[model samples]
Target: MSADIEVVPSTNRKNAFRRRGLLAAAVAVAVLARVFMFDHQSLDYIAFIKRWYDFIAANGGFGALKHSFSDYNVPYLYLLAALTHTPIPVLAGVKIISVAFDLVLAFFVYRIVALRRPGGWLPPVAALVVLLLPTVATNSALWGQADAIYAAFSLGGIYFVLRRRPWLACVFFGLALAFKLQAVFVFPLLLVLALRKWLPWRALPVVPAVVLLLDVPALLAGAPLKQLLSIYVQQAGSYQALSLRAPSIYQFFPAGADAAVIRPIGVAVTGLVVLGLVAAVVLRRATLNPARIVLMATVSAILVPFLLPSMHERYFYLGEVLTVVAACYLPRRLWYVPVLVQGAVFPAYLDVLFPKGMGKGGQPGMIIGQAPPGGVATPPPGGGRGPVIMGGGPGTSMYEPTLEYRILAALMALAVISVLCTAWREFRRS
Candidate 1:
């Protein structure tokens, strides 16, 4: 009997070590992919560095605080500015900071996933898949974007809320909002905490209080209200065009349609669709897993911008991060799809954003075929091969179409459908 017990303990140790080894190998691959494969030339890094330097030089270090409110609401700007005094290269500093945040995000995922479903291979698998996602790796290490940081805070907030720590959750959620406007999309999920009666309804003010505390620095720095509002106004007014990536049912339409005509129509349709989904979930008595709620909110946020006319690829950052957060609670099989989609989309989007020369068998001139009116391509009156796609100009075979967009669209659709069905099923079961 003693020998048998000893053998069982020994086997457990070996299994633990094996799990650790797999995790270590996975992390190494993720890190190497980010550092060596994708960090070729980070445009976003360069932009942030230049913007940071300009902010510092123009307005003393503290003065740079104004830029945060007036331009991007990214709180990390101040953090990055604080690091400027260090001898480290700006790009290196940014990459280090982002990677650190990614690590925190990974930890948060582990905790959240483990909490939702205990003692399973699914949590670790989910965490590993999230860490390895091409987009997450590339965005954090290569582009040096702070999406990971905001995502960390968002996940932390969700975790705390799940643990019935409302105040801490509020603080973390506020910090997330300070990091990026995308955090607002998750704001509604806070009601879950209130619904659970984890905290008094009056305690809800703590969230805005924390947000104000973060913004106080800028306010005290003499940033004007007009300027502050301008940041939002600029985003709202600009980019009235449409793209295939839009999240709405409207994406089925051709691009370049008039915003006046499409905007209102799209808004009404999206509102109805959103309402319908919410009703379905609620009416079905779905199980209110905080992780799944976060996933839905994240998907909603991502789709909001996509469904809206005129969005950029970077807009998917919030959704990508939320997908990671959702992975913590998802079954292992479900986790791999998002990971693969994120990985595939990140580099492809970057390629389009910052192209190197044509790959092969590609001529220079624009491949102008007759696109219907309101399509992405604007055909001439003659209907024979429209004008060149102006941004890169003709001969930019690098701009040639690839399967990336189609793949992403398909995967995203699959994910949305799968999650919705799962939520409905779980709701019914509950």
Candidate 2:
């Protein structure tokens, strides 16, 4: 009996060591992959980020915050200002910041998966899956966008909520909202928890409070208080299109239809859909569990962007990441959830990054460049119109949906339904 006990411990130790080695290997590979993508200059970088870096560098670094240089919120701009003083090349530095958060995102993915699948290989492997996921890597490393920052915080919020740490969850959610309005994609999930009274009402105020606290530095730097607070409001009004090639429900709209007439209907429908999901959560509150909450969050992340107006292609970044976590929670049934969501979102990235078409004979090359006389181009006041269309003629909107996008729209719709149904079944399970 003593020999048997010793043998079991030895075997468990060997398994644990093997898992750690595999996880280390995964992180090394993920980092190397991102290093290769570090040099690719995306259109958003050329048109917006590069100019903002220069403006921050030229205008007393942090002092530039006072001026409305970028449409992005103060939190990200603060990073740019700090980067101005660093020796690292601005392009690489920007991606590195996001890459750090990419790892943070993966860590949270691992933690969340471990909550249910503890001491197994699946959790470490799930972290690897998140790091290598095409959109996750490209959004930060290739595109140099900060989607990963808000995404990391949002995932932290979800993880904390699952741990029943409401205050921490609120703080993370607030940090996410401070970085990007897209963070609201997960807000519905948090709201559902609040309604169920699982998340305390006192903790709810922490979110906006964290956002406001993060804004103080920029406010002190001379950024107008009113304009600073209204960044998201301004962003919403800046775009006129119903959908920015986001593979959302708007894909069904007729070409050249008046956005003014269609926008309100889309908003109202989105509100109704959100309320319906919230109502479902309320009705099934008794069956709620960590796994069910994860699925509900997945539905919110995907369905909101899938239904809302004026969404960008990358708006579903949160959904794509959460699908991986949801699938990890119930691998047998939810494995295809990430597959479908990633499949739908990846092509949209290609549409902007390799707009020349990644088709049978298409060559991947720069589609367009709009640099100023001697420096990177600056986007017009609100923000640059969505990324450039390589071969499309004059007046072409980058958000224009193709047949492929329409097909992906169906896939995204299916994903949202799949997750919602899974949550419903979870509620029904004995």
Candidate 3:
């Protein structure tokens, strides 16, 4: 009897040690990811800090509250403006608030993953992947972008939807949308909930209602609704001079393609693609797994910007965050594709962050030369030649791949192929 008891105790001890080891490993991964991605001194973070400080100082305390609404519908600006009233430097306060949001997002990701896979390491592992994702880390921690905060609230809204808390979900979703319009991409998922009768159809109106409620403060501050409409119009009309080279129909065209021609075609094509994805989800609803549905919705969102004529690298934030969530739930092999795509964009970001020249015109290839760390030795504004314009002026341009651009394009192509194959297979099975 004594021997039997000893053996049982020994077995329990082994199990305990295994659990402890796994936990330690997870913590180590999280630590490494945080340190590598968010050192607080990174160039992206510093730039964001500077920008926030300048805005606050120029406007005077609470001044941003009045002016910020004109720029973006971001409700978080009010919170930041409030924080600026504190004795701490506005920039530092912004960073602290941002960091706090990051931690909260990480927690949500972990919790959601855990809910899906009890006692499995997938939750923590997913959180680690999210932390390590180059774009997410850079945007959230370094650039002080609100993508992380919005994504967290968005995911929380999804969680509430899953839990059958429709009202709460709508409120959170409203907040997420207020931060960034990209949050609308998840609307399809909510529709799924409504169709399935998991959420009351009546709850649907709450989303737009919440948005209007949040906008009331700005509306009262003499912020014309037309200004908000104009922002969307400007975004639609203007083309970004520089963008990550992702695989899209655009690649088929000659380099230096005219924005006038590209913009309309891009919009139409992207719209079709989004519609197709939505149809696929609706058609496969009977057989589709929750994970697959979420993944498809996310891929659709990511591809939309690429399909649109004028896309900035920052636009990828919406898709990248969702991809990270999808990766966590997906099989291991599927995860690597997004990981590769995420890494591919880093080179482009590096190019932008450490541009070859400053005073030079923002031309494409103009190598004004490198600037040293904190060195003002480079010619002051207007001294150097502008960015080198790649491709011949107007017609007769040949496309050449920069190492980073080529890699990014290739990775995006791979992602498209993988997703297509998976979707096709699932469709056939159904």
Candidate 4:
């Protein structure tokens, strides 16, 4: 009997360890898969990190870091500094940084979902689902952009604000701003919340504080204040086009549409939209619960991309994330929103990534300089405006508004309307 007891105890311990080991191995595989899977040596991989690495090599470490930037902000420069320290090739390091933030982004999505109703494995499951989301995967691993990095902070800021931790949320929002201007998609929501008294105005200074902290280092290290500020200013006119790969009403315009006309009108309309949202929140300040707040925030984030000029294919990234959060929060049939969004943007992503291999060339991450001056230099030949022409080959622009592209764009617009109308109805019922 004593011998049997000992054997049984040993077997149980072994099984426990085996389970733990297998779990660990699974995680390891996932990490490695992201790290090394799409290590295609592309030009962006060169411009983003390798070229920076070369600058560090030629200019002696951080000595030249201040003057080396094109349009990326200072927090990303800090990332570049840390990357320079690691011996892992600059390309892999860059992608790893984005991949790491991809997990952080998913975690924030989980928290957002869990805040509504915390019960069981829903949060973890949400995180995993977002982890494997197609855009999230491609942005970090395949395209190797830092969209997820700033996006994580932006999402965290929203989560904390919902949690009533305004200061921490502002810090995160600041980090998001310091990382990239795209965080603007979510920043205005905070402003609306503050104006509605959801957050204290005193908590707002953290935004500039965090921004100053990120910028001061470079400024002190010899980066010109004018040059640094001008980076964003220049971005406004960087591409004069009214639309890039973003499927929007801009798709209706002629190929060579004038952005001077579109930019001002888009700004006016975006202002009106934001004013309407702010008025709604302010007028209903009494009932502005988490549900209402999230709905408004989600709608605001989508509106910026949906209405803005010079928008890029990746611009809807925040919208996609917020839509997923809205779906979990509202838990209605939101497949339509994501399905339309991914459908509209996936072709553009393919064109950017596999331009030559697939014979479909579209815009790449020429973000800092990707905006066109006005209208496409080249529209689809003969301007076939039916639904979608089959041959959007190497020469065709993703912004060419093929028949299929227009159909997808229209679906995306309808989906946004559907989400907003549904949220409003639910808010009334609640």
- Give the candidate number with the greatest TM-score: 2
- For model 2, residues 1-430, the per-residue Cα lDDT tens digits are 9999999999999988988987898898899999999999987788778888998999999888999867899999999999999999999999999999999999999999999998878888898999999999999999999999999999999999999999999999999999999999888888889888889989999999999999899888988999899888888887777788798988878777789988999899999989987986687656568988888888889989998988888999999999999998878778998899888889888877766532223433222335534655435436644454333444455565568888989888888888888877787774
* lDDT of candidates 1 onward, in order: 0.60, 0.85, 0.59, 0.70
What is the Cα-based TM-score of model 3?
Answer: 0.76
Write down the lDDT that model 1 would get.
Answer: 0.60
Tens digit of lDDT per residue, candidate 3, span 71-159?
34537656665776678755456555665666667677776677668655577667767766677666654555567777778877866
The alpha-carbon lDDT assigned to residue 103 of candidate 3 equals 63
> Which lDDT tens digits does candidate 1 get at residues 348-419?
566533544323344333323323346553332222111223334422323223355555555556656655
Candidate 4 CA-lDDT value: 0.70
For model 4, which pairs clash? 239-371, 239-372, 240-372, 256-375, 387-403, 387-404, 388-403, 388-404
Between candidates 2 and 3, the one scoring higher on lDDT is 2
TM-score of 1: 0.77
- What is the clash count for each candidate, in the order shown? 8, 0, 8, 8
For model 2, the stretches where C-alpha displacement exceeds 4 angstroms are 357-369, 372-378, 388-395
Regarding lDDT, does 1 or 2 come out ahead?
2
Worst 10-residue lDDT window, candidate 2: 358-367
Q: In terms of TM-score, how similar is model 4 to the real structure?
A: 0.82
Query: Model 3 misses residue 297 by how many Å?
Result: 2.9
Predicted candidate 4 versus true structure: per-residue lDDT over 1-430, tens digit per residue:
9999999989988876875575456546556667665677543554345555666656655556568344566677677776777787777877888989987898798788889867455565566666666777777888887889888999999899999999999999999888888888877678778887779999999997998787887787788787777666655655655776677778777765666787889979988887786676566554667766777777877777878876877788888887777777777656457666777666766655554422135323222112235723222222211111224443333355567657767877886787778766855663
In model 2, residue pairs whose N, Cα or C atoms come closer than 3 Å (at least 3 residues apart or on different chains), thus clashing, are none
